[model samples]
Target chain A: MKYHLILRVVTRLLVGPILLYGLYVQFHGDFGPGGGFQAGVIFAVAFILYGIVFGLRDLRNRFPDRVIHQLFALGVLIYAGTGFVSVFLGANFLDYNVLAEKGYEGQHLGIIAVELGVGIAVFAVMLAIYYAFAARPPRIDDKDW
Target chain B: MELAITLFLFCAIVATAIAITTIRSLFAVVMLSGVISLLSALLFVLMDAVDVAFTEAAVGAGISTVLMLGTIALTSRTQKDIKRNNLIPLAVIILTGLVLIDGTLDMPSFGAPDSPAQTHVGAAYIARTADEIHIPNIVTAVLASYRGYDTLGEVTVVFTAGLGVVLLLGGMGARSRKRRQEEEG
Candidate 1:
């Protein structure tokens, strides 16, 4: 489908900022409203926007399915790894206190790590689902809608 | 003023939800659902649930809309008129709603100081988060540090869901090959 010139241009301009904002939300989540889930969705939005404007082919080339599949599992591993590490440090499972000498610092580190895991997993899943749906041929024409 | 805003947002949400159900065009339905999500996000903000609001806006309005659009692209644009009876489903829904309403009637009023929710660990979490977690946001402290196990479980759930979708969608190669053969055959 041929997209409008304005959409194409605007999407190009917007994708970078959207991605930056997603990262900002992910990192600043501790002090602010957003956390991993929200940031991940926002991050997925940038790619989704790119796919919509420039075509899914362009998006798939830049972000191949293989990498997405790996990231999907890797994210969960990161979260679980943090817990296992805490356990190895003579603490209970997912006990962030053992992460650092100072309890609060450990909590801070654990939160960042866990939130990253959540963000990455959510981001990949959203894109993966989008790819799955868009990969199929449309039964109806765009004009019909 | 808060009450007025809450009422207005609720009205918008109800109208959008009704419109979504009544609309035959899948595209319009998707748009209306997004509107409902955005309105709900606004309501969440009014109730001082900013994190929930952020999530609703991003997931509900943003990603879900895009996913629904992709679904419409793959499937039919307009819903089919089915002759199947929905009476049983309607009755089931009404019964569930009535049960839920009855349950709520027994609960404490909103923000009651002595309520079970407010009394049990809530005060301790709020009081200790500053000293223990040193985080200004108590929600973050609880979610990340205190309740890390729960968050890990949530991530695992998301991971499991992603795995299911990948398998259901036929990974990559098999799906495309099947599609090509279908197009050619």
Candidate 2:
């Protein structure tokens, strides 16, 4: 319907900007009011909006179920990998100081990296869930030969 | 100013709780619960617990609402009427409220700089964190470094919940395909 098209266009315009702002919040959270979790929700909201307007089927086709599953696993892996890397470097687990040959800068870098991982994982899992719930299975018609 | 904010928060909490308990529609109750969580987060911020507020706002208000709605979609929207009186639940809630008020009688005054929470290891952490971790936000330093183990546990809990959802609601495609084959045979 005409209303649906309007919603789609509006959502398309909104999603991109919201997603960008989410990334900005994720990175700048060290000095801001937001952080990894807030960024994750904002990122997820973009896709939720897309699913609402364009239909969950189209959104799923764009992201796909398998890719989302992988992203979920990959996010956790990135977080755990950062901790493991710290252990390997002779510091305790999640010891960001061991991340680089230098000192405090390494810790900062490590935190940012881990935050990014959490954001990505949370965003993907949330979107996958929303899509899974909203999507309806196709129906077959008896007249379809 | 702070006292007024605290009063506002207390009023909001009571209002939300009443709304949640009395609302007949499940969706309205869920949304009101979210409002309660958000107000509690603001109260946390007023208490100078920014990190806790952040987590609460994100998890309690945002994700919990979404998850609850998903569960609602999978279940009944309205509760079945019961023949019995709901007096027992009402009595239990009243008893709980009385016990909590009694407990608060022995608690530290709000915003007291020398409260036990502020005097304990928390003070040391705040005082030494700048030199020790060099991070401006002591909350971040505490979360990502000093008590990183707890953060790890929190992450694991989230991951487990994600797994639980997948187990409960996922893999539908495979099951549906199998059902189709059985019907054909």
Can you list each candidate's DockQ?
Answer: 0.77, 0.30
Q: Considering every candidate listed, which one attains the maximal DockQ?
A: 1
Clashes of 2: 0
Q: For model 2, state the Cα shift of residue B73 in Å.
A: 4.0
- TM for every model, in the order presented, reads 0.92, 0.86
The alpha-carbon lDDT assigned to residue B18 of candidate 1 equals 69
Model 1 CAPRI rating = medium
After superposition, the stretches of candidate 2 with alpha carbons farther than 4 Å from their true spots are: A136-145, B50-61, B171-185
Positional deviation of A116 in candidate 1, in angstroms?
A: 1.0
Local error of candidate 2 at B107, Å?
1.0
Candidate 1 lDDT over B1-185, as tens digits, reads: 88888888898888888677768988888989898888899899998899999899888988888878877777678889878788998899899999999999989986578999888798899999998888787787888778888888888888788778777766584457577799999
Q: Taking the tens digit of each residue's C-alpha lDDT, what string does model 2 give over A14-59?
A: 9889889888878777665666667887888888777767666577
Query: Residue A21 of model 1: what lDDT?
Result: 99
True contacts kept of each: 0.76, 0.18
